[model samples]
Target: MPEVQRIVFAGTPDFAARPLQQLLDAGVRPVAVYTQPDRPAGRGRQASASPVKQTAVAAGLPVFQPPHFRDQTSLDELQALQPDLMIVVAYGLLLPTAVLTTPRLGCINVHASLLPRWRGAAPIQRALEAGDTESGVTLMQMDAGLDTGPMIAERRLPLPATMTGGELHDALAELGAQLLLETLPDIEQKLAAARPQPDTGVTYAHKLSKQEGQLDWQQSAQALANRVRAFNPWPVCWFEWQGKPVRVWSAQADSAEATRPGTVRRSDERLYIATGDGWLELLQVQPAGKKAMPVADWLRGSGQALQSGEVLT
Candidate 1:
């Protein structure tokens, strides 16, 4: 067996943690880990640890949290690691040419979507939001351009109609780990080859915003269902209910509502909202700070039934 190389790992969210753990389990020694700085999160607005930081700590690795990678001190500190290779996954930060060229093997990224399509942040969410039938992960070299690196490896995953962003995220995370391990030997031996992405078929996946999560009841239930799945864990799909916010967790298409868009109609054991061509069934929902509940339970608990002519924004 060949000797292991010194790796400097960079990533921030849970999507990046799995492959980092895989590299460690594969006997590659990481000199240092880089992740985003902790910021306020959750209901109390407390500073929270990033998933990558937690994983690195549990693995007993040195961790570096930097607000950005532009200053002289941080660059010097990272260069001091003397890494043979840098493995980056969902790091959520752009790497300058100096940092990119620091490692002997250069920096490799684990992107959630296949290259040339959905080539930016929030790829998984954007794919689902756009109603794509399939999405896959691709491993590539890191360039100054966003996800424009040359590809070293690729693996495809099915995007089932029932898959939520959280579910797809976990599936891809596991698949990405396996792919990384398989590619390492080739990379170490200088046998791995990369192909440049084509100019055609390129699309940028902009980051998800709070506004994108708002449900427009006028759309077909199928469209709303996709939104419900795409935004499950963050900026969740929601609508207004008598001027209050109600987050939708799961939804399905129906065809029985006779009222206008945003009209909340009820049937036994179900809640239906009308659309231009179909109706949407709200399976689960969260009312503000309260826990998620079945629509039936929510309707009963609130001591109020959703009535017609109510506009949800």
Candidate 2:
């Protein structure tokens, strides 16, 4: 077999594409790129390539889209590449032991969380929902277990109280790319000195579902506001208004008092709704079949007749 100087990249989304692009731009080109197969999306349901696939194609790298690696052929094909190392970032598939051991230098994963915490699917959303004050990326030496690997390096970012999930995702993606570039030069030494994650503070971020968007007015105002921040850009928090769903894009909790939960409360040109505790100010909203607009603009137009003391739920 040829000397194992080749790197193999496996990732699927835009978050993963950033690191791959960094690798290419730094002249550390992968011999083969592996991404998930095209899947249906949008109103037409037409097949669409993942962001990582697009990046690999534009860079003129060979691409692979095996459905799974359970079959021997997939393992054989991967082994044939004679890769020195493999880098995985949100590849969406679990790697079997066979494939993990194929690379001469093994595999490394650029996980979005600080490791041990938010160890599964929706780390960004989970962190936001839990109101974590900090977030970061972990460069891990891949193991058979789920994100339970030795950490080679980590980079932390302060989580602002008002930061939305989409904003944090973008910030971490860029930070992960920069850290990956910096770590590549001393990867061997870093892997050797990697430390084990503590058993405490372990948490799992389960994948979110569309049903999670349904807003419950009975919850605490702060809790509801966190959900709105967590679920933005996907499965957005919403409430039924006049038989149509109205997406809540941005909101905040205040100390205003109201008679009951879901009761609309106003203070000096601002709109707030009572929850189990305090009130939630609706900053931005998007009604079905309408673009997102400020609460004031939406109120002036569609919300002209709606008055305070009215209930949202």
Candidate 3:
């Protein structure tokens, strides 16, 4: 194994921050940290530092926030660091070939999904949406292609039937952190032994959009239920109800007979929506301008007079 000195880290978001924090906690601090530039966030739309930048700042590490490494000046600045190795996790920027080879040992990325699968943005959500029974983290040697890197190390985690995207994200973040820590001790050896990902079974996890969160009643009830789990804590799944959008936070698939695709029924204090195959039981939902609550609570309160056989578009 080669002696790893002067490490550089590049990442953004909470998922990336966790591994950076773990590195610091383990006394393997990076010489410099690179993150995306501050951007407008939240309802205020005020400039806010990314989670990795915030963590770097708190640790008194040198922080660089370049919009993208498209300029010669940015590339020169990174080259000046003379990093022995660079660790990237959810950095949200495509690194050019120059940056990839700048480091002595090259750059490595901590991706959320197993390589040749979910090889783009929104992997966690995509995995849940597809109803995969298992998910894992992959540490790969970075290449020019998008997440098309050779695998250095990987760790798998079983997915329960009720796992949500948010839940899986948190789990995989910590798992990735642990995997990175373990790989660092023998990084050179692992890199030397890294294997190319198989071309078969490849699937891209396309970036998510708010429009995709709209529930399609024509889909199977189980599929709709999976979507509800996949999209939670994000552009949550929703349906139009009386000219307003009702967000479905949590739901379950049932074998109840289907009526019209979008028809809704109330029974035994539970709310059910008919789908192509069966029914989807709405466990939690949020009205257009209200907080999310259980189906029973919503039924007793604002949804008291919700008529059975009412259709949700």
Candidate 2, residue 301: lDDT: 80
**Tens-place lDDT digits, model 2, residues 1-313:** 3343688999999999999998898998999999999999999999999999999999999999999999999888999999888999999999999988999879999998988999999999999998899999999999999999899999999999999989999999999999999998877778889999899999999999989988787888888889999998888999887888889999998866646888876644568888988888899999889999988888878766668788977
- For candidate 3, what is the TM-score? 0.98
Tens digits of per-residue lDDT for model 1 on 1-313?
Answer: 3444778999998888888888888887589999999989999999998998998999899999988889989899899998888999998888899999998778998899988899988898888888998888898988889899888889998799989999989999999999988888778553246888889989999989988898887788888888899998988998876678889999988866446787766765678887776888899999987999998888777715665445454
Clashes by residue pair, model 2: none
Which model, 1 or 3, shows the larger lDDT?
3
The count of backbone overlaps in candidate 2 is 0
lDDT of 3 at 208: 98
The local distance difference test score of each candidate is: 0.85, 0.90, 0.94
Which one wins on TM-score? 3
Candidate 2 — which residues are off by over 4 angstroms? 1-4, 267-269
**TM-score for all predictions?**
0.92, 0.96, 0.98
Task: Name the candidate, 1 or 2, with the larger TM-score value.
Answer: 2
Candidate 1 residue-pair clash tally: 0
lDDT per residue (tens digit) for residues 1-313 in model 3: 5599889999999999999999999999899999999999999999999999999999999999998889999999999999999999999999999999999999999999988899999999999999999999999999999899899999999999898889999999999999999999989999999999998989999999999999999999999999999998898999887778989999999987899998888965899989999999999999999999998998998888787988877
